[model samples]
Target: MTQPASTRRLAVITGASSGIGEAFARAYAKQGVDLCLVARRLDRLEALALELAQQHGIEAFAVQADLSKPDATDRIVTALAEQARSCDILINNAGYSLPQTFLATKAQQQTDFVAVLVTSVVSLTHALLPGMVQRGYGRIINVASMVAFSSGAAGHTLYPAAKSFVVKMTQSLAAEVADKGVLVTAICPGQTESDFAKANGTDQLVAKSNLYKQTAEDVVAIAMSANEAGREVVVPGWPNKLAVAFMKILPDSWTAALIRPQAKKFALPDPTA
Candidate 1:
């Protein structure tokens, strides 16, 4: 039994201040879904919220909180309760990569990545899943990366591992919730034109790879379509899909040998250099 779109179609989007997150917010707003936008930058979130509301005539509420914090999920749940809203869609899109190699990066930084990339997502999904299950309609889009399908290169050990977890979890959860009318999908986008490049100090690399890069809007469109169709995982671009497919058939030993020589190309430069 499908419910009316106006009944309980509010969406909760984390990392909604910029980049792919903001793109998802705008996409959902364009579909007339009310939004609860979460991000650390209160000003940006507020401004985006206002803009979306005016431009799309959809309700947009900004919740300012760092997803890296341990209590972030609780805070979000509390805010939603206060508003008498329950989440119909959850876009767990908040994450950032540490620049240094696994050994060189601070232990605390690694822990914080786990908190934001893995724990926060699990917690928020747990908090929101019950209402969605009861209502018998929901959508969850976990923003992973194309790297999720392949082994790490350079200083990106935890990123691929965490994203791999998201992809696997989405698969399992899709199986569990399929009969309940809820869809879970992992959106794996390749190099994208977003603030990610600026934050990681890879703007030059990104600019050089413009021919292979995807726009945030294009990625969001693919993700939304995947979610609607209950796709377990989606790799956005044709090149990325081809690359991942090739990697899948390649032997691990050969893949590792090939990647080792090319690893330095993706390595981050020393901040002090």
Candidate 2:
């Protein structure tokens, strides 16, 4: 891999254990960017850090933390502070999914959804943005889902709900900080092939994923490029863009109805739903 533009430049990525987060780590490393990797799995993180440093010859610092927990952001801040650190780019890629209907979902699991998706993303961004703002140049990327569009599926409500918050929050934050040269971006990807199925309990659809699946690396490429281009929100893939547009054009009732069955297909049994 060619060295990135500046050896001094470093990026922080959440959810770096595997899947989408790992893809982002590899992509950033390819650009010669040093990395601060955060995730729950220490072993997985260490492996990735080693691979990145060895393959791309960039520094890699692994910090293991469950991003869904309240202390996750604090942990990241401490890691950076301890290393005399600050990131040139921040990627809020940590998230969780529950594959059941709202009514059938577990209460604690539901809370986990909010913790990882909404709370973690917000707290991490809040904690990390000050330095970026002061420095007058930085990149902040938030990973969202195309389901965030009004086209939410039946059983996957909380996931989209959290991603919706991410999308709106990124847009608003982008508006606030863009003038300072700090870019805030929300990337919404649709039906990308990922380990999300197994982790989130959607493994049932694994065989059918290829119908609309996207490789994790491909999604990361578009997202990172869009951030550099100052795009606040980027829905990768033409199909994803069309889906977003359809969500806007279709009537709420009709859209909701259409989304219901799809949600059911991937849903975890929710008691309250």
RMSD values for the candidates in order, in angstroms, are 3.7, 3.5
lDDT on C-alpha atoms for all candidate structures: 0.86, 0.85
* Tens-digit lDDT track of model 1 for 1-273: 953434537999999999999999999999989999998999999999999999988888999888789889988999998777899999999888875677777788899899999999899999999999999999999999877877567676688889999989889999999999899999999888789867767666556543478899999999999899889999999999997886688886776676655655555764544
**lDDT for predicted candidate 2 compared with the true structure:** 0.85
**Each model's total of backbone clashes:** 0, 16
* Candidate 2 lDDT for residue 73: 89
Runs with alpha carbons beyond 4 Å of true place in candidate 2: 1-7, 269-273
Q: Give the residue spans of candidate 1 off by over 4 A.
A: 1-8, 270-273
Give the CA lDDT, 0 to 100, for residue 261 in model 1. 56
